[model samples]
Target: MGLAKVSSFLLVILFLINGGSSTTFTIVNQCNYTVWPGLLSGAGTAPLPTTGFQLSSSESRLISIPAAWSGRIWGRTLCNQNETTGRFTCVTGDCASSQIECSGAGAIPPATLAEFTLNGAENLDFYDVSLVDGYNLPMTIVPNGGANGVGKCNTAGCAADLNGVCPEQLKVTVEAAGTTGVACKSACEAFGTPEFCCSGAFGTPDTCKPSEYAVFFKNACPTAYSYAYDDGTSTFTCSGADYVITFCPSVSSI
Candidate 1:
């Protein structure tokens, strides 16, 4: 029995030495907000991805701590606004124009506004989306064939657009961050691809953030790139079109 106990203790030590150790951590945005891509940096100049992990609104992410990650938790929040959900929206807050590209994607862009800051035991970052529906012009341009291009939004933050004007402003708010207390509503499980509608304001849905990218645009004409919309009545252009954005707690990996 003593030999068996000794064997078990040695096994545990081996596991620890093999770098199979794990830690469960939680960053509660007790402020009634959502901290996106909540980056975590520990013991180094750069932060690490809390990846291969799953997290719940109230749950923590289980991460495999690397031996090389020794610095302390050092990371900043980085977010910018992008694209319209698919509704009738445009500049000047006008919803009466069919020419205006709209979206039903419910996202309040600037999702958790408080402006760029770091989030760590030493620093709790804050952000607020200030991207209004306008242009997106990134200093570093990467054209997607057509007018589709990356740009900055009003010198404030990053944004996506069809051209000239943004499909809609990427709104960022500054309210305390909090969880919906619910998981992402099961991918709209009712009928055809779920379709969210807008109440008033800009005739668009407040599609929340971490705006994903599209694999193909409805159209792209060398100098122009646009996304599909409204049963195909019009397409968003990415020519002079751009949405600019400014973010702090700067992300080196944007």
Candidate 2:
């Protein structure tokens, strides 16, 4: 082969050996009701194959994620379509896209989020299920088939249903069937205060401390992020792992 062609071949081999392979995300919906899952790639990251889609109970879908991709996934509940205007919307975790696909829009607050930073520093994939935005439904991230990395590849999520026990001040209710709590709001989302939001005077971790509301979530799901600075126990790391993200995972399995 020509020298240029040989060099090109060598580069291709190097790319495949060093983070060129894609990762698979298997999204499962175990809720009794339907769920509309939304995905948003981080700024400057490549877009995913599909931004949003519907998943009936017991249904699942597989998505291929390029190496080094970073993004979040969340499920929308109580979604409906407006026949007159052909608009789509959800009671919780709506992306405001007016369609099933979120396009590039992120979830509205009060949504449970499974955030991922794949192939990051030290080639570890950092992941966490966050209620820092608030809680909508039970969700978990289970890493599979990863080589031992910096941190344990343990499951991370808020598998407990927080809506029913949510504080009245943080409850989001819908009156469709009757008055029902569908989601719980973070103190920041509920009150917009500097302390709850960890902003302004409370921007630093030293100044911002978990409040009563955050403590409620922490007590319920010790491994999930309960507030802006609840990082010590919330984050998990793995390398070259395919993820299984399940919404409304069974308590016994969690």
Clashing residue pairs in candidate 2 are none
Give me the runs in candidate 2 sitting further than 4 Å from their true place: 1-12
What ranges in model 1 sit over 4 Å off?
Answer: 2-6, 17-20, 40-68, 71-254
lDDT of 1 at 149: 36
- Encode model 1's per-residue lDDT on 1-254: one tens digit a residue: 69999999999999876644433222322112222322323334233454212122333333333322322211112222335643333222222222221111112221211122223222222222222211122111121222223222112222222222212222222234342111111111111132311123324434421122111112211111121112122212222221222222122312
Tens digits of per-residue lDDT, candidate 2, 1-57, equal 999999999999999988789999999999999999999999989899999999999
TM-score of each: 0.23, 0.95
Choose the strongest candidate by TM-score: 2
Total backbone clashes of candidate 1, pairs 3 or more residues apart or in separate chains: 67
* lDDT at 167, model 1: 23
> Candidate 2 lDDT (Cα, whole model)?
0.94
